[model samples]
Target: MEIQENAALLLIDVQKGFEDEEFWGRRDNPAAEENITALLDRWQETGRPVVYIRHDSVVAGSPLRPGQPGNDFKELVEERRGKGTGPELLVTKTVNSGFYGEPDLDTWLRGAGIGQLVLAGIQTNMCNETTARMGGNLGYDVVYALDAMHTFDLTGPFGWTATAEELTRATAVSLHGGQFARVVTTAEVLAGASAS
Candidate 1:
């Protein structure tokens, strides 16, 4: 598959709050941040457009609450934002899908003429997955950078616990091959970026 020259990189909810294992439970993909940084760096270097999605949870006791320290972006991502090497858009959301965020992700992408999106960030099975599905439905080419996202273990209503790794794998399996997004590794995305 070919990546568009103007494909936007959407970094969803790579916040400090996600570091709280006590709140989110055991997580997988320890190198997620590093992989996300790699993709961000490449985008910045190429002067590609980037959208930063922040989740400001309204749920009481949520670490991602607006006034909480955990609501801020991770240090590495924040530092990259400081460099100002590319076009940066901020989308703040209370929900899982970045498409439903403040400033209107779809409108902004349309106005900017970006038809393809490369996703990388936190909660592999939640925000990232939801955004990819929405993006696909909206007729945008979506790329899911699987290795660049992580998720915490989740307990189902039926009382079974699914490990983070399992969820991540399942999400990839469900989304790839024209289902919703093209699920691939960070290295593959970077290679596509370079080639595009």
Candidate 2:
């Protein structure tokens, strides 16, 4: 698919909180950050809008809670997080879906006349999945940058546990086709950025 002028890269919750392997517990897609960096670089070069979605956990003592060091954006994106005059938008949310919390990302995008979004970030089965679903439900063209997002193993009811790989695959399966978004690798997104 071709890139649209109104499309912006929506990076959700790539924060230091998720960097704690002890807490996250065996995440899949180890290269996710690299892929996301690649996309960010290309987007910057190609002049596509960039949005950074940060999560501020309402639960006290959570790594992502406000005033915590882990709540900050990961160091991998430090240089690209933007300073004065940079063409980047910083959006903060308190929930899984970036669109649903304070500073309503959906509303901001709509006001900016953005109608298409490319998603990348942490927890593929949670925040990323929720955002992609909302993006489609809200009538926006959404693309899932598959390799640029990841998730940790999750425990189900009883002793069942789903590996991160399984969750990632499930997310891809659920979002692909006409459901929520078209799942594409980071390469495709980078190519689209270059071609644009």
Candidate 3:
């Protein structure tokens, strides 16, 4: 999990919205935010670029509506914003992938010459995973900071149930070994970041 100089941390939807337990239901990885914070600290200390993707949900009554309190960045990210340290860019998206909508992350990444992305944040099987897959298809070296991402339980229309753990495992299985990204634990990611 050695990170290259062009590697940047891409945090997706680490917003206050996800904190609403009733809205998101039961989630996994209670320490995901802690891990994301650690990564942010390391990236800031080392002066590596960090980017944040916010999900500004267009769905009315969604927790991520732009004017809602839940739409605000998580306190951890907020405290670091515009400090010129942790996140050098913040891209907002209306969909599952950060590469879409206005201020597209793909264009920004290319403009910044970023070829490697270390992904961390919420909804492992949703926005985070979508962005990772897109990054891989676009030929960027992608790494999944596994322990730094989390998701909630889901029930399909047919009553099929998937726990957060199961979803996370599926994402790892789908993305590993050059398919999309190599998944690494947050601890491993921290160590690698330090080493780099």
Candidate 4:
């Protein structure tokens, strides 16, 4: 689980929209913010590359609409800005996949010779899952932090409602053991990064 010198952290959509207590307030992935902050601190100290992706809703007047406060990175993330050795790269995207039809994250990663990517973010079943799949298909060594991603209960077409804990655990199970990516705990990631 150790992060190599060429490793990078891809933090996806830890935005104010996802942190809105009034909306998605019932989600059960409570460790997400703390995990993300811990990883951020480790990445900053180690001088590893950290790339942030912010989701922008294409629909006008949505919570994540452009220029809205909700579209910005959350307070925890904003506080760490400009404190790292290098400038933080921020990619804004209109779709679930950050690499889809926009800033070309794959190309950028390849150009940087980045082979390992550690992913942490919000909405585990949506943006986080999509990005991890894309990163795996693109040949990056992907590590998904299980406790560092959050998802809300979702009602499926058959009227089945998945609870928040169900969604989080399901996403973790889907990502772990090589169906898509390796799932690791935040503590594991931080320890590995520190040892690297």
Candidate 5:
């Protein structure tokens, strides 16, 4: 916590595509939207820089395909957007990492003099994790909001299917209290940012 003046909030892929029941629905962390909303409110109140990243899937007919309704932020998240206060920047990328080719999130952060990033949003083990890793590698101190990220149950080639909850927890354990990032609750983040 305790965001520096040069700190910015990076909200990754809180899109309607993920929130839609027909799409990649059923997340492990249902509270992610609420947590992200709380953080957004606090960031708005403090006038801290808030950056929103939207993922544009390159695959045709993907839920996040450009110009689709699902590409927009979900209802809960949409409530946080406007001209007055909330997010200061909205960057769209086709890759899992926001720093990838696209709107140049890394360059924007650097231009804003941001050395610290508070990250939150969907798919804890994917987009969120990738962004956090990239941020850490790029020399930014990252703080991941534990309750503000989520993922879906995943089954791959290992004959093992991990629930979203398990993936989220494991990702947090690996990121928090480590060199990558500090994982903290929304309360801790709010208090720290406020105090800062």
Candidate 6:
């Protein structure tokens, strides 16, 4: 895997709200935060651009809603803010796709001359996946860091439930091989960075 020197690391919806197992069922990828933190550190160290997306849920009582403690970024991610030499951008969005966020992610990326994106964060099949698809469609090289993302179990309309691990695997299958993004492990991405 080749990661461009200027590729922006998009950390989507890595907030404390995702830690609420009571609100969001059991989740897969227990080490997701550690992986994300590692990638963030490397990107900052190498001076690669970084973007953080926060989901501000519109649902009246959602954990991610404004004024909720869950809306804040996790401590590890928050600690690295403004520590990187590369530019940092924060995008707040109510929708699943980070591209639709305020200040306009696409516009910001375009203005910054970024044409490649590396994605990681919460909800493997939700915000992260949606953002990857959008980034691909918009002609950016999108890399999906599978191991750096975690997702909760989901229940369908028919009441059939899917395990978080199953959903995460499905997300990887659907996004890999030029569909929406290139799905790779966190180590793979970090190695690519180191190689570059």
If scored against the real structure, what TM-score would every candidate get?
Answer: 0.96, 0.93, 0.95, 0.93, 0.92, 0.97
State the lDDT of candidate 6 residue by residue for 98-192, as single tens digits.
99999799999999899889999998988998999899899999999999999998998877989999888888888885488899989999989
lDDT of 4 by residue, 1-118 (tens): 6777758888999998876766665787687899999999988988888988988889875678778889999998999977887435778888898777357788878888889999
Decreasing lDDT order of the candidates: 6, 1, 3, 2, 4, 5
TM-score of 3: 0.95
Stretches of candidate 6 off by over 4 Å are none
Winning model by lDDT: 6
Q: Residue-wise lDDT of candidate 3 within 1-196, one digit each (tens)? A: 5887657899899999998999889999988999999988888887788888899999988999999999999999999876644448878889999889567778888898889999999899999999999999999989899999899999988879999999999999999954899898888877777734
lDDT of 2 by residue, 1-196 (tens): 6767557899999999988888778999889999999888777776778888899999876889889999999987777766322257788888888887666777788888888899999889999999999899999989999999999999999999999999999889989954799999998877766643
lDDT of each: 0.91, 0.85, 0.88, 0.83, 0.83, 0.92
Model 6: number of backbone collisions = 0
Q: Which segments of model 4 are wrong by more than 4 Å?
A: none
Give the distance in Å from residue 15's predicted Cα in candidate 1 to where it truly belongs. Answer: 0.2
- Candidates sorted by TM-score, best first: 6, 1, 3, 2, 4, 5
- Candidate 3 vs candidate 5: the TM-score winner is 3
Residue 137 of model 6 has an lDDT of 94
TM-score of 4: 0.93
By the TM-score metric, which is better: model 2 or model 5?
2
Extract clashing residue pairs from model 5: none
**Cand. 1 Cα-lDDT:** 0.91
